[model samples]
Target: MILSVQNYGQNKSIAKDKIKVLENTAQESIFVHYNSSLFMVGEYMYYKIYCLNSETNKLSHISKIAYLELVDKEGERVFKQKIRLDNGFGQGDFFLPVDTRSGNYKLVAYTKWMSNWGQEIFFSDDVIILNPYSNNQRDFLESEVSKEDLQSKSDLRPSNSALSELNKSPLQLFISKKNYGKRDEVIMEFEGINSKKIPDGEYSISVRKYSPVFPNQKKTTVDHLESKEISPPTFDNNITLPELRGELVTGRVVAKSTDIPLENLKIAFSVPGEDYQLKIARTDVLGQFHANITKPYRSEEILIQLIDDNVDGLTIELDDFASPFNSDKVKFESFRLNPEMNDLILKRSIQNQIENAYFKVKPDTITSNVNELNFYGTKGITYLLDDYTRFPTIKETVLEILDNVWLTENKNDKYVFNLRTLNGEFNNSEFTSLLIVDGLFVKDQDYFINNFSSNSIEQINIVKEYYRMGSQIFDGIIDIKTFDQNYAALASKNDMTALKLNRQTEIKNYFRQSYGNESSKDLERIPDLRQQLLWLPNFEIDDTQRITFFTSDLKGDFEISIEGFTHTGKPVSILDTITVE
Candidate 1:
């Protein structure tokens, strides 16, 4: 039943060209045609075959023997035929005949070396793909923008070098000899780049996360060198912006009827599975604020919380305005001040002022957690521990409920704890503690079990792994008091610096105490400069006999104002030695 055409050609012995072929083996009458134009997708159809040069193996410069065949689904060779080709891999046509009623078929028509093996049977896509290319891109905006400038020197500061700077997360880009043109030390200087005129959409900010190795100069010949050194975390975040890059955000506040714009208002949006929240922004004069944040492949919805401690502590202001807000005094009218329409007036009545405060909280996530809770002035934090997970202890034969797990830290010297806004005394006390110590969450105010005895804590699973760890992941030393054996370590460092003294460092410290009132332009104040000896290993002045210190600008020259102190830590003698070297 196999159709043969090799013996039927008019010039069978001398036929040196290839032919085209087609087949039908499906339920529905399948149409086989090359819809090539960009045209009606259904117009560029007819019938053709390939005539390969046989010398080269491609349709472009080789030989081809093409044919069309119509066979039954069971491998029965029904009809074998041939067609011609006018163009290569372009618009053309071929037809097939079927005997079956209706079902499905795979009509594959391919040349010996064709790139895109064309298929006639269309089975369109029907599955979801999760490859990198398949995922949606993240949004560049819609994130928090800190008011601080970041640095590459310290990971803590807001600088271009810090990995935590905006837009640097999620994706990391590097320039290396391995990837780029064999170059090392790729120094990108943005001394004249401006971002003010750029539109507000997202753009891929490129930066070199890694540089190449150092160059090596061998004997006579120059070989490729790689030192693999890392620069301190600095932000190519461009160091400075033309201004506090801003945008507009719209919102309304009813209870505090004052038309004054909320100042220093912080808004945070956290995408799930993300390392950090977007950013915290400050409000303008009219309680209006806008934060500039970016996220690639942004999440659909983000978690947002508005906070301002000076104007009002999150829960504190919410508490003070509770009664008035609930009553008619804090009524929210329409837009304007129409007496008949009664647009809610911003009340200036309550004056419970807040000194300092912060919010690192989230909304309640447990059913037992309070439904509606209020905090004054400060913005509401949404993330909180609201669950009691019951676990069985191996040593103790009883079920224990674990509840009120919270985050703790310290600011200055005071401690803070971000607790769930539950209708409980302990947690409320914790919120009060946050106001006193700025944004710190400390150990004392940590949310704990309600009725469980301290002895019942057979296995307290301190979630240390969940925190950014170090000497104080909890942000404060909870286990040991300031100075005993543990103080041994801190005391050792102080004592060690207490070792060698460079006459220069000794003089600098002394001058600062006399001037600047012991204040520093950096994040902290300069140490009391006047309290040091010239010959000590600790003060780090163990340099030379001739000490030289100079004051900035019009402050005057560097004078080694030497002074002696008694055992009681009081100044005994003042020796003013003005050295030249």
Candidate 2:
């Protein structure tokens, strides 16, 4: 609900008294390193995001979340992704669909903290996408290239095995040979140039075929450091806070009938999964609340609800997923598709189709590296329902099968539960114990006790010790595991709100083509028509740093580029060419 002017003024005063307003001193900027500026249908656009401190030119630790968007010429968003940052670095990839129109699109990246200043601090680069399957190419192929334009582009092309140095790069890239055949192993070494000391840092490397139709779209590290100067924003009461801990989800609450802001209400946020997380936050004086999700969750949806008895009178509203920055300021480049690129585009499109058909044999793995512990502690007494005698209702099941847990009804016809302590007794406290079903919080005790039974539940866990979440304290815990683990089906939908969260992008182990191993026999029948041989978004430079990869079956001059920052915050950008004959 939109707050009135008087309410907003009171909120600002309360915010000033409660929160410490931080000045925009250490401003942040983003620089994205992408694999290619040109793409076709079924091809993936790989990119790495570098969140840097503008003043120091080093990695910024201010924000843990970054946003990447693909904006079209009309300032419309084609796709948007929310990426999780690790030490000011993050990587993600998107596959171009066959239905995408051929045009020049802008790839934009920025953090929440960077959005406060404006679009000037955002990292934006023009990209060309060609779709042979679609006929909508008016924006790109409206006019033919002039004879002088073609000559100018051809004259600027680099020779074979040429190296383009940027900012007098300290590191040197070495290759074993200038030319190689298909499926040949290529080893590259990176070291200090002229005995110069190479500062330690993280870097990314990409080896892709150089297509003549594409322009010079690669951005040097020095260009960003020199161009993006941080201008501290003027002090304002409504500044966007940096996500110092984790992904921050902010929203407001208001009365359903009067549309008035509801303040100081406790809200529960649940990310339901096998390894779920439960957090609680209270709305401020302005009816706005922020919850920080520090842990990783597999579920793509989350539940948010008020934790009070008068939840039905309030409406919980969440902020929109669209970026707050204005997209009209983005300047797009005109893409003139030359007539000579027809055959090349057809060849690449066919190769992409062939490679995608055999994607099952060459699969990428989605990582599932998360903590196994549940939100509640692991030390709890678990009772398997199948081991006990069959019971009709949960009330009977708890009394007969369970040991130290007791469930009874009060005079108001509401069910209550308590955990027995070591003295073979329990306290008669007025506070209610926490109840969970399939990792979801169930506030209505009568609904769970009357609806759920031994037939639907698989097991029950009881924790006798007191557990605390946010400002609410529970006397004990009674976590019920459902047979289907269907929290949505069993959860009380009276006052709860479910939202589809833009969860962290899944990190994939990109399919690597290797001809030296025994598994190569399986890939012999599969057509190896790969234009981009290798894309390492996170490349480590160890003590004996050596990078190796095999060239694809496609013959061309591949561009090998490395972009990153050193420990001393110095930018690093190096480019070299290798021909595969």
Candidate 3:
């Protein structure tokens, strides 16, 4: 005998008079709260889930129905998923994907939908990552996140994303040398350029260079410092970068009996003085010293450091900021001035060098060096910009993403207002009083279309304002934040009005079920705030002219009688300020 009776709100009939196969409901252990495991190195997050009905009974269509793996404590599995089904009875949601790594995981629900051919409905459990890239408050308190489809962002998940760069433009810091009373040979350079494709990584010019010029104490405190490794060389228009190689003169150093100038000691170049072995030059914050010459020390003969006893010496005057017989010496890099240069601090340094010239880009054609130094000055990163060999590619680097974050120019109201409708002749398709957003409603469009259904939103942040009847319809109030939730991340408009507003207006009216199958034990014995505002779905009820008036999708109110509006009944007028769109 083969019988069947699947019912979850009724619907299932197939008894061909009976034949066999009715063994479904037994091995059930559903508990998956597997939560979004932690991650951040490359970043990703997901947890969506669905699978219930106490376990689809009398089910058979190819048997073995459940699978969702992700193991990694040596038992090794990293990720897996499978859930069979063909017709009739159904179930779907199962995202998971954080990629893998960082400890104890397992959201298994196996019995073999294919772990190479299954047989173990044993429901394993243990997903506890803790800090994947971190969004803490304990993951918004273990988020349950309701409704979240928000807007069906077409499946986007290309490994986090970010590769747009054009860095290197902070060059020129030629340290203090010009003081050649007899040329003490000293050089230290670090200019940069590699054809402006900058992408070599390990960069840190930092610079706070010091000189033989010392004497500015704040109760001093110097500590012997040493860090050497140069000789990679690169000079000239390519922009010089001898790394910092060539400086050997480690002499003088004694404090066992009061040898003046040792106010804050910590010296070590390994002492030897005068050309090769006494690299004495590492002092700053007032006891200045710096050395980096690769030869021609102005006709050589070095041997200076006379004090702490490298056995007394004399032959000073190191580079007075460049002067091989000086030629009208102007000034810039090494603080060398006197040629009278001060047009209000070089016109405020040429207005911050032309407002930092779009934050200096010009490099990275795919890791050739120089990345993200404001690449074309800010937008959501993912840029291998010029010659683009595959960067920022999630369908053409999406509106060059700049969820708007780069500040330093007066506050302007904490900005972010770019919600469209200012152009295309600013139309609201006959406004039925739209513009809701302020929320306590259907999961706020389920967290605004499920956390950013994929890029295209370069700016939009109204926040509050939407009159009605008296008309202001909505000057402010837009809540779509998305950085990447992936609905194919839309946002194109310079008239593409993001593919012409996506036209989807179909709500063939239907609403009458104030409360059915409710339960918190009937919401603790009927507190019926009018059938829970009759199921939301109507907008504009803020600047307080008070008019909720919805009738479907559930219920609605805020009605203070102006006939409790929704005007569902089309009336005449009050001061005829006319309102019907």
For candidate 2, lDDT tens digit of each residue in 331-358? Answer: 7776677777889888888888888898
Local error of candidate 3 at residue 511 (angstroms): 53
Better of 1 and 3 by TM-score: 1
Ranking by TM-score: 2, 1, 3
> Residue 232 CA error for candidate 2 (Å)?
1.1
Score candidate 1 by TM-score against the native: 0.18
Write model 3 residue lDDT over 1-581, tens digit each, in one string: 01111121111122333211222222222223221222222221222122222223222223223345555444455545433321111122232333433343444543221111112223343343322333332322333333232111111111122100111122222323322221122222333243323222111111011111111011000000011111221211111111123322222223333444433322222111111222224333333334432221211223232222232221222222110111122211111111222332333334333423422231112112223221112322232223233223222322343222111111333212222333323333332112112111111122333333333332233322232311113333332222332222232111110101111112112122222236323333322222111111111233322221211121211111010011111111011011111
Sliding window of 10 residues with minimal summed lDDT for model 2: 1-10
* Candidate 3 whole-model C-alpha lDDT, 0 to 1: 0.24
CA-RMSD of model 1: 38.5
User: What would the TM-score be for candidate 3 when compared with the true structure?
Assistant: 0.14
Q: How many clashing pairs in candidate 1?
A: 97
Off by over 4 Å in 2: 1-14, 17-21, 149-164, 193-199, 256-261, 386-392, 422-424, 541-543
Backbone collision tally, model 3: 70
| Residue 464 CA displacement from its true place in model 3, Å | 67
* TM-score on alpha carbons, each prediction: 0.18, 0.91, 0.14
Model 1 lowest lDDT segment of ten? 216-225
